[model samples]
Target: MTQILNGARKCFVQRGFHASSISEISAAAGVSIANIYQYFPSKEALIIALIELDLQRHRSLISRFWSTDFSPKAIEELLADIFLTPEGHAVAVLRAEIASEGARNPHVAELLRDSETGLIGSVHSLIRAAQRRGQISNELDPDLITERLSLVFEGLMRLYLFSPANGQKLIEQYYRQFADTLRLRP
Candidate 1:
């Protein structure tokens, strides 16, 4: 199943969702088409699996927020891990492809919504925790903060994708601004 998912991801990244075929994925996986069908009923199912896998990884990363002392440096590291690394760039590209597919596919769109909901919940928890620690202002609503942060993250991903050369600098600027805004003032 992992092999199939990895192969599907590679193929999807290279050829996109619409152009990638089950046979191509199977060949890339070094498995038979029948084997793929045994695990995933359709290409859409495979895509959902990949999305779920990505979500699991995100959940793991978010969990780290709870274990560490909340600080601007920690947040910056998280952002860098998401936006600046080679693996991060690959995931961003794959996410863009998945998002494009979701625009036209109701099932994909629903899955994306579900994924976002889970992520938002995790972020909400992070905000609440920061508030408890006096790292962030308690006067602000966690729900609102989570929503705005989600928007900022989406914009950052777009900036990184569309303007690679300046994306890192722009992200750093945005992060600094974000850190300043959230930090509690004496």
Candidate 2:
């Protein structure tokens, strides 16, 4: 199942969600078409599964950050890990694909909504924790802060995908600027 999902991701990235065929996924995965069908009923199912896997990893990263006790140093590290990296061009491309697919496919859209809701909830918790510690301003609504950060993330992904060669450096600069502008207090 993992192999098939990986293959589907590779094919989708290389040929796009609509253009990529099951046979292409099978070839990429080095598995038979029949085998893929046994695991995933259709191409859409495979794409959903792949997105689910990525979402799981993302949640894990967020959870790890959530588990750490809040400190200025820890917050800085978390911000760098979350905002300053491109997460690789392949993953970025895949993310774009998923977003576009979500717009046109109801199933994908629902999955994305659920996944994003969880992500936003986790981020809101982190922001509230930081506020409690006086790392972030108490005046700012946590929900609004979370939404703004999510927009920043999406904007960075777009800029990165536009010019992947300089994406990491650009992300680093953007996050640095954002951090500097923040009124974080001890």
Candidate 3:
């Protein structure tokens, strides 16, 4: 199953979620069609599994982030690590592909929503911790702030996927401005 997932990830990364075919995944996995179907009924199912795996990884990353001292600088550094690297771009593209398909596929949409909820929960926890530590303003509701932060990230990812050069420049500018704005102290 792990082998199949690794193969699917490779195909999705190389050819995109929509363009990647079952045959291609099978060839990459060195698994028979019957075996693939036994594990995953359809490509959609396979993609959902991949999304779950991604969510687990994201949760792990956020958990680690939350374990440390929460501050605007820390948030900025984490965001840079997540959005400014090649691996980050690949994950962003995969997420964008899933988001596009989610618009058309209700199941995918539900899965995406679930993943987002998990993301928001993690961010909200971090924000609340930062607020408690006087690292960020307590004026705004943490949940609302977390949602807005998520919107900013989604916007950044969209720009990054569609326009790389402009996106990198914008991310640099945005991260600086965002870090300053999010900081409670001078």
Look at candidate 3 and give me any clashing residue pairs. none
Off by over 4 Å in 3: 66-77, 165-171
Q: What is the TM-score of each candidate against the true structure?
A: 0.85, 0.82, 0.80
What TM-score does candidate 3 get on C-alpha atoms? 0.80
* Best-performing candidate as measured by TM-score: 1
- Writing each residue's lDDT as its tens digit, candidate 3 over 1-186 gives 999998898889889888999999999998987889999999989999998887787787767766555454665566666566777777877877777778988988888788888788778888778788876788858776666556766787788886665645756655565565476454
CA lDDT, every prediction?
0.78, 0.75, 0.76
Model 3 worst lDDT run, 10 consecutive residues? 177-186
Model 2: lowest-lDDT 10 consecutive positions: 177-186
**40-91: candidate 1 lDDT, tens digit per residue:** 9988889888877877876787677554654556666776776677677777
What's model 1's lDDT at 103? 94
Q: How far off is residue 108 in model 1, in Å? A: 1.8
